[model samples]
Target: MNRSNASRGGVAVLVLAGGEGRRLGGGKPLRRVGKRTLLDHAIERGQQWSDTVAVAAKSADQVGNCDLPVLIDQPGIGGPLAGLASARLLDCPLVLTIPCDMPFLPDDLMARLTAVLGNEGASLASSGGRIHPVCGLWRRESLMQLPAYFATGRRSIMGFAEVIGYATVGWDDHWFVNVNTPIDLAQAERRID
Candidate 1:
């Protein structure tokens, strides 16, 4: 892991806590993983990648006391796309989108993703042949294409990646394991041990 690149570029990280977390009984980001909430872990880890870490939550009220700036989803609650756009609008060179529910994300994620910077719009981290779209890094410039993509009403991140052609960066599957259900949280708890 390249600790040296911990703070790279004028990058900003957007922890997408705007999801309803319907699969995990709601407030998943605030769920405890060990001694810390998932949102706490997300923000703590996010601080390593960028000095300007912000959160995109469903409502500002959901993350009121967070150390970072919290932006509410625009009137529509447009999912990760809106979060990504909000982060980009900060005008940073790169903005990494991480799902708040993914507490065990690799610490070196931003370094690994930005390692292939000059590739297409962005390169998603892939493990075991599955693309972790929300666990990926994107350039602020990529937002230029998002508006047009949103116009099509297809909000899938993979769909947008396909339209823009992204490079693939490989990482260990454990590094990208997302905790969505109680079962997943239990499994991740064991993994951490």
Candidate 2:
């Protein structure tokens, strides 16, 4: 939703568009499925549920037509953790971290994510026995523990999740499919279209 018309509970939207996508020949964020680029799809999806939505891009040019703030990954591509660290600096309490590649994320994703936030920190969406770490909702306060986790050279998102604790919310697995390669994009396009 538009931030101007959004309700209470300030939620920040962080779209992970900084990956090099070595498997997809780089600049995957700009790759098109039909009419819109993958990054555009993600920004639109993110904007639907939050007042503020920003793209985490390696370079300003990569995000192209997106009007939202484009945040560069700190240390320049240390992975999703770096993206989360950058996202935490935003002026909102809750942050919705989504990947630009996952164009078909459920429309109710933000609602579902925020609905399950508790004393533990945040909630992650799990489907078909796999946890979608990138499709997570976290509190900005929880990010204080991340710098140490990154310093320890612990890169796995799941590993970090275990330390902080999270609740798993299940949904249809197909909805969380992320396009990592050209083949994956083809498959997702067919499914989503």
Candidate 3:
């Protein structure tokens, strides 16, 4: 049986690791933040929300040694949306999406997103008027709406969120800082220390 499909209920965590991370000199998931790689940190956080956590990557080779299932980006689609598209296949009603680089993503992410999920297809995280659509809880049934949305040739994550009528939960901006550069990694290291 597929590891991702082993769980039939409760929220599943999908850690997005498919980005090329060119800005960080590549191999972003393998980059170290203290003792663990960025991907390791991400998986650790995801485990806080669910035992059925998976990583979404550009390829298995990119993900390296992750014990969790790696959902490769959909053939024709790329980026976080592709990961989400693939994650929807997991045997869970709700999927919580997190990024590989954001080590400090709010611990209460699931709590906040679930509070607003209500009747909408999604509940995204926003901070200081900026939306972090990738770090959100998604409805698997609603994710079935992707093929039709992509049919229009529009790939913006926010665009699909809008099409599905999403709700937003606010957080302090510092909680969403992602490691995308050497300096950003240094900052994360400092934050960890």
Candidate 4:
């Protein structure tokens, strides 16, 4: 589906591409796995689950060729929370956050998370007993609490989730492998091949 058809279900997909990619020598979103950039792969997956897909990057230049709406993270606050905070600008009631570097993110991620979201306001993805805090679905109301959280100088996505209370949807560990370094990009290339 195209961007015009997205967010029809009251959910918006936010792709977080603001990381410095220090381990991968920077510009991780531009790194290619075959003919496509990691950001391209992420946008593709995001479009599959939501009609209103957007990118949360430090700047529009960081998103490369993807033409989705860009949400610039608030300066001075780092990590996924910044991206989550940027999402508050969206009109949707629910927001799904996905990291750009995870090329193999699950197709059913939104379905599983939304199914269990219930009345608690949020749901996060978990694999092999490890929670992927960035891969979460949050209520817009819950996100309003973030600015205060950032004010306290804390930026833990998991900590924010714990305070809001969230459900966990377990997935296969292999699916969430992220491309944080050159080696990971190479490995992702192999998987794509």
Q: Which stretches of candidate 1 lie over 4 Å from their true place?
A: 1-9
Give the poorly placed runs of model 3, Cα more than 4 Å off.
1-9
Write down the lDDT of every candidate, Cα atoms only. Answer: 0.78, 0.82, 0.89, 0.89
> Regarding lDDT, does 1 or 4 come out ahead?
4
lDDT of 3 by residue, 1-193 (tens): 5665344248899999999999999999999999999999999999877878899888998889788998888887877888888887788889999999999998889888999999999999999999999998999899999999999998888888999989999999999998999999999998888
- What does the lDDT come to for candidate 3? 0.89
Error of 2 at 6 (Å): 4.0
Clashing pairs in 4: 6-51, 6-52, 7-51, 7-52
**Candidate 2 C-alpha lDDT tens digits along 85-167:** 78877889888899999898998888787788777666888899888888898878887788777778787777777778888
Colliding residue pairs in candidate 1: none
Error of 3 at 42 (Å): 0.9
As for candidate 2, its clashing pairs are 1-48
TM-score of every model versus the real structure: 0.88, 0.91, 0.94, 0.94
Candidate 1: deviation at residue 108, Å?
A: 2.3
Worst 10 residues of 1 by lDDT: 1-10
lDDT value for model 2: 0.82
RMSD of each predicted structure = 3.0, 2.2, 3.4, 2.3
Model 4 clashing-pair count:
4
Which lDDT value does model 3 have at 116?
Answer: 93
